[model samples]
Target: MPDISHDFVDECFEPSTARAASADRRMHTELAASLHHLAEAVQTTDGKLSDSLGDFASNINAGRFVRPSVFRHYFQLVTSLSSGDIDATKALISKMNATPPRNAHRTITHFGHPDADQISLELISDGMRLAPISDTLAQDFGTLLEAGFDLMQNALPELYGEITAIVHEILLGGAPHGDSVEFDGASHYQFWGLLILNPKHHNTPLEIVEVLAHEASHSLLFGLTVDEPLVLNPNEDLFASPLRQDLRPMDGIYHATYVSARMCWAMETLAASGHLSVTDHETALKAAQADRDNYKKGLSVIDAHGELSATGQRILDKTRAWMNRR
Candidate 1:
């Protein structure tokens, strides 16, 4: 069996110097562009909510948006850039501050129906403004998430610590129809350390854990690679994704494979713990096996099409070693 130690996990997770440098450059460029855009937008409206502002907010809330946290960061950047002269920018900051908290609609509800003492967080009408899930259903969804976190704490304490340290906020929203869980913690959200999760699709603790692990891994990698490119190849080359039917960029493939490896690790930990119910244990084992298969498929694509720099290669090599260890 492969050595599955906390040290091994840390080694695999560490970013290379090249990656760090690349990420730093990318961040500098992005920050400059973001500040410029905010300046333009603020000037246009004199700091008030212009049509563009409304549209931007609407687009973000509608799904398929870049990091909303960027808006928050831009608020400060704009304030600094304006030298306190932009009242509109100040108003924008105030408005954002006054916006409803992410969990404003949370309430306690019974897990199932009438008599279950098990309680869960529910999001009512107020939450509907951001997500489609009803208050009652949100409770069950939140419960599953809590349970998943508990499992991670118990079975994968190292991962739990890493995630808690890296991920500062969890933003709940509605998933697109047919999808149970969604994650958006890519490079765009790296500045704010936020994870956007749509919980309506997860029905079990295992499912919740899988998505959490997958997304959190992405966030961790984003932090690691913020200063470097994962692969040197142009993103024009599309390849099959083991996690989805649609073709994806090599970077996406790397992310999928890496996260799949993490998922496999988590599931294996759960399966071996013998702490789960019989059904859950079986499910975890099956999921672990499937993730292993997917990891291999993704690895083949990476080997064939990926053009990793030295740093990227080091990261991929570590992940490959972990996947192939057993």
Candidate 2:
């Protein structure tokens, strides 16, 4: 992961499940790196704080650090450390959960309509027009995630397992429901392994399948950028979004292009798998075509304006090769 000189990014591009899994494991080096900085700052200020954090850091195993809750704590620690607020740092350290993280290293094993306690504090700050999904919708998600992940397991086991390695929790909340940017689902950079989805927007099982691939692919992209961005252009560099009405950053455009094909792959596999009902089979095929069309639309935009990094180019190339072959 350091320098990425060996092209570990291929784990995500060429779609090697094991390599993708390894890439995730390699990402923990970031927590270790973050700790290195924090430890340096706390060393002289508070010996007890230093000893406490030192013990906690030493206890962080590969399994424990992979938790999204721990990821949340990591960022909070960084903020506290940066502000040099020893009292806030101590308070945060005091509240740190050493409980075994609920992030099971598996995909679709858990579906939660999380309470406020489980949500990120940033949710309140977003000012997003959000409503809780109906109980009917909440109940349906378990079935949809189960069925959709089953399809992925049967058709694209590599991607399925890679999802297990990437996503830890599937959560539904803040349903903007086709109104704006977070219409169907989203993966925030701050809450790394959590997929916040809109239960109301996805009307069919096929739609849920597409959203699964769509947002989880976004989570995978987030994990990829733990060390470096996927694009060279700044966030202010806006471009037409294939998925959204508003202009988005170059990175968003790049991700939209790549994940569209991923959504296509999900639908195509389920469509051809002969496991769906007659109606769902037809729906999956239509969805697959829609994704292909959207992917092409986004690809044209990328060809026109993308200023991608080396990591971005390889990923785009692999996406191009995959889409062309199909």
Candidate 3:
């Protein structure tokens, strides 16, 4: 009995010290550095740290937070799996700020129509892993890199060459900021990695190349290694539609003319390369054309009151050209 008691005590003592040391090691190296880097990056995007944690919570709920270090460890795990995204975050905050706590579970989600999916910020860390996508994709990316380009250093590509370069960098490192973008579709912005639409969805390398070029165009226009600071703080409405109270009043109308036009140019480029089918091109083209009225109105208002830089004018011109062509 005496020997057994002593063995148990020794076993507990040794492991406790080892565990403590392991924890300390992580704190000193990876954890601390990553946290600091994240803090810095957030400052770059949001312009201040006074409400960073709160902003982080908002981004987390909106499926907007995408820091790589946060992804690599429990730091990201807690935020991604535990919080709601933008919509949920707003509702949660509204409820919490209302005066009393509700009876909802600690893990909460938003509900919509029956057919629509109710998003869950539950157990996200369980499945997300960053690993090799495919040897073929990697090889293509490498070839682009060997051609003397760095995704982080250049403007977004007008062609496939630049897109390939950007994708390689994203695979090797990660996005310039957050992990992904959730604008109706789940695409990663230059905010994280350089990704276009999924290749599997389209089933052709040419199409993949075209999508890559389109997204890369954003990377160039926005920023190579980091997303530009928002001209105005964006919220749920902006995400859903650029036409929102917060959007600039173009003759008292908030619209997404510029974005629609740019996307048209990109898709048109893809169609021209035979990367998109005529059907797909037509679909995308119609969408762009639909925005023409909005664009014309917005441009009129902007020209009246807002200034357009040389580069901005060029982007709009190219997009319009792409849309106008058959």
The CA lDDT of each predicted structure is 0.59, 0.69, 0.34
Model 3 ranges with Cα > 4 A deviation: 1-158, 169-182, 185-214, 224-258, 270-281, 291-301, 304-326
TM-score of each candidate structure, all chains considered together: 0.64, 0.86, 0.33
Give candidate 2 regions above 4 Å deviation: 1-6, 11-15, 103-121, 127-129, 134-137, 174-182
Cα lDDT tens digits for candidate 1, 1-326: 12322233335543223333333334334554554466466555454434444444443434322333443545454665467555655555455544433322222222233221111112221132233445566566667778877887787667676665555445555544564445332223423445555665567777777777788777666655544678877888899999877889998898888888888988888788866899999999999999999999999999998988665687777877777677
**Which one is best on lDDT?**
2
TM-score for candidate 3, residues paired by index: 0.33
Candidate 1: worst-modelled 10 consecutive residues by lDDT: 116-125
How many Å off is the CA of 183 in candidate 3? 2.8
Of models 1 and 2, which has the larger lDDT? 2
lDDT (10s digit) by residue, model 2, range 129-235: 45565556667776776776777777677777877777777666654447545556777776666776766577665666678788888877776666567788878
Pairs clashing within candidate 3: 61-84, 61-85, 61-86, 62-85, 62-86, 63-85, 66-179, 156-220, 175-192, 175-193
**Candidate 1 Cα errors over 4 Å, as ranges:** 1-10, 13-72, 75-131, 176-191
Report how far residue 72 has shifted in candidate 3, in Å: 12
